[model samples]
Structures are given as C-alpha cells and as structure tokens.
Target: MKISEELKYTSEHEWAKIDGKAATVGITDYAQDQLGDVVFVELPEVGQMLKQKDEFGVVESVKSVSSLYAPLSGKVTAVNEKLKDNPSIINKDPYGEGWIIKLELPGLEEATHLLSADQYLKALGL
Candidate 1:
C-alpha cells in the first residue's frame, strides 16, 4: 500500500496533513484499494463540527460501504464536491485530489495522539 511520509494516520486507515491550525483529511491508499471501485460518497455539510473519531460520512464502493471518521476535532470548512460526480478519484489519488475534507482546527491536542506514517504502516503489518 502507498503511504505518504508527511501525513499522520488513524488505525481506521484515515490520513491527515496538519498545517498551521488547519488540516486536510482523506482515506489512505490501502483503504480505497480494499474497498474496490467507489460508487458513492456521503459528505458532511461545510459548517458541521466534528469530534475526534466521530462518524462524519460514508463511502460506498462496489464491495462495501465504509464509515469515515474524524481524525481530529474541527469545524468542517470544505468537502470534496468532485467526489459527488467521480468518487473513483479516491482510488486514483487518495492523498491529493481525493482528499475528503478541510478542517479548521481548534488546537493540536488530538493531533498529537494520531499515528505517524511509520506507525500506521506497522499497525497494518506492512
């Protein structure tokens, strides 16, 4: 599985890039691969508040539907509107164009608790 060295990850296979007080979030490459071709995505509204690990949305693939969790608490500033039309971008570029949300974080308290790229790989036994 492809993993970005700059991102933090969750045990659930989500990845985050924290920059200043904001973050970009998405499923890992491993996650999209396991899910097969994605058919649909359910995204949260832009103003919604999410806590760490809260179920924020759903991703429906040819194989299964998976719940997306918040890797850190924040106000949702944006969602990937492109996914509504072509969810397969997730499988194509999970760390870039496939990113799911942009969060305006309150602090890094929860961010510090997340897994590093190396730690995440170890958790997956890669």
Candidate 2:
C-alpha cells in the first residue's frame, strides 16, 4: 500500500493532490489492490459538478465494482481519457498516470477536512 505524503486522503479511499484551486483525484493504491485488476472506469464528463462525497464514478475490476467518491465540491475540469482504453493503468500507477479527474475547487479550505498520509495510514491500521 503506497501512501503519498503530498496528497490528502479520504476514508472512502480516494486521494487528492491539490494545486492551487484545482485538484487531481484518484483511487489510492490500497483501493486498486483491493479491487484486483481494474478492467474499466466509468467517469463523469468534463464540466460536471460534484459535491463532496458524491459518487462521481465507478471502477470495475475482476473482483468487484466500486463507487468512486468526490473529495470536495467542485466542477470537473478534466477526466483521464486514457483509462477508457487501458483501465489497468490504474493498477500500474494509481498516483501518477492513473489519476481519475481534475476538479476546479470552489473552497480550498474544505481540503483541511482531508486526512494526511500518516492519518490515512493510521485509519487503515497500517
């Protein structure tokens, strides 16, 4: 399980890397590991609005299908279109090339509610 010190984490297992008012979001390494060999990703369109904790997409793996949650209230600025053709990239590099979406954050302060890498590790009993 890889946890990025630079990113914020949610209990539901999403990670967010904030850059000013925009954030890149993805399922964590732990999440993909649990899902087991991702085969498809169903993501929202660019320009869609998402509330914090909303089910923004779904990830389907050989083991199961799981909902992908929003980490903050924002408009989606971009989606990882590459995943449509090669969803297994999420299993290969979840924090890098496998990032799911970029969101235009309306309240950067809401990020304060997110867990740090240490906190997220503790939450998982790691």
Candidate 3:
C-alpha cells in the first residue's frame, strides 16, 4: 500500500492533503486497491458544508459500495468531475487524478488530529 508522507490520513482510509486551510481529499491507495475497479462516485456539490466524520459521498466499485467520509469539517470547494464518466481512473491513480474532493477547512486544528503516514501504516499492521 502506498501511503503519502505529506498527507494526513483517517482510520477509515481517507487522505487529506492540506494547503493553507484548503484540503484535497481522497481514499488511500490501499482503499482503491481493495475496492477493485471503481464504477461510480457520488460527490458532494461545491458549497456544501461537511462536518468531521460526516458522510459526504459514496464510491461504488466492482467489489462493493462504500461511503466517503469527511476527515475534517469544511465546505466543499471542488469535486473531481472526471470520475463521473471514467471512474476507473481511481484504480489508475488514487492519489493523483483520482482525488475525490477539495475542502475549505473551518480550522487547521481539525487536520492535526488526523493520522500521520506512519500511524496510518501501523493501523494497517504494516
């Protein structure tokens, strides 16, 4: 499993790449691998507010359907519309082109509580 050192993680397998209160979020490499080929993604619209741990969207893969959770409280600033037509990109580049959403964080403090790369790996028993 590929864990990004610069990104913070959630126990549920989401990753948040923070930049000046803006966070680009997505499922971890391990998550996409387990999900198999992604077929659909239901994303939150821009301007939608989300609290930490909130169910923001859903990802349907060949293997299963899973809810996408918010790792931090924020307003959604962007969604990866590209996934709508070609969800398989998630299988191709989960941390790059497959990133699901971007959030405008309410505060940076919320980010601090998320897992580090090592912590996330440990949680996976790696």
Candidate 4:
C-alpha cells in the first residue's frame, strides 16, 4: 500500500491534501484495496457543512458499502462528479482523479488532529 508523505490521514482511512485553506479529500490506497472494487460513490453535496470525523459520504464496492469520513471539519466546496460514472478510478488512481471532495477547512487547528503518513502507516501496523 502506498501512503504519500504529503497527505494527512484520518483513523477512518480518509486522506486529505491541504492546499492553503482548501483541501482535497479521498480514501487512501489501503482503503480502496480493503473495500475491493469500487462500483459507486455517494458524494456529499457541495456547500454542505461537515464535522471532523463525521461521515460525509459512501463508497459502494462489489463486496460491501463503506462510509467515507471527513478528516477535518469544513464546508464542502466541490465533489468529483466523475466518480458517478468512473468509480473504479478510485482503485486505479485514488489520489488523483479519484479524489472525492474539496473542502474549505474552518481553521488550521483542525489539521493538528490529523496524522502524518508515517503515523498513519504505524496506526495500520504497516
């Protein structure tokens, strides 16, 4: 499993890539593998407010449906509409075209609660 050092991770397997106040969120490589082949995604609406550690959406796989969680609190700015038709992109390129949402983080303080890639790998016993 590849975990990029540039991204922050949540215990729920969500990953966030911070870019100033804006952030792009997605499930990690480990998550996609665990979920098996992704068949569909139920993305949160743009402009919806989400709390840190809260369920924001769902990723349905051939095996089971899994909820996608927010790594930090914020208002959703955009959702990747491409996922509706190409959910398998998550399994093919989870950190790129597979990104699920973009959020305007409430504050930088919330970022402190997230884990570094190294820490995240340790948490998973990698």
Listed per candidate, the RMSD to the true structure in angstroms reads 0.5, 0.5, 0.6, 0.7
Taking the tens digit of each residue's C-alpha lDDT, what string does model 1 give over 5-85?
999999999999999999999999999999999999999999999999999999999989999999999999999999999
Window of ten residues with lowest summed lDDT in model 2: 1-10
For residue 78, model 3's alpha carbon misses the true position, in angstroms, by 0.6
What ranges in model 1 sit over 4 Å off? none
lDDT of each: 0.96, 0.96, 0.94, 0.93
Clashes of each: 0, 0, 0, 0
Error at 21, model 3, angstroms: 1.1
> How do the predictions measure up, each by TM-score?
0.99, 0.98, 0.98, 0.98
Sorting all predicted structures by lDDT, with the top scorer first, yields 1, 2, 3, 4
Worst 10 residues of 3 by lDDT: 1-10
Candidate 2 or 1, higher lDDT = 1
Model 4 TM-score on a 0 to 1 scale: 0.98
Comparing 2 and 4 on lDDT, the stronger one: 2
List the candidate 2 regions with Cα displacement exceeding 4 Å.
Answer: none
- Clashing pairs for model 4 are none
Question: On residues 3-89, what C-alpha lDDT tens digit does candidate 4 reach at each position?
Answer: 799999988899999999999999999999999999999999899999988899999999999998899899999999999998999
lDDT, model 2, position 53 = 97
Q: What lDDT does model 4 reach? A: 0.93
Candidate 2 residue lDDT tens string, 6-108: 9999999999999999999999999999999999999999999999999999999998999999999899999999999999999999999999999999988
Poorest 10 consecutive residues of model 1 by lDDT?
1-10
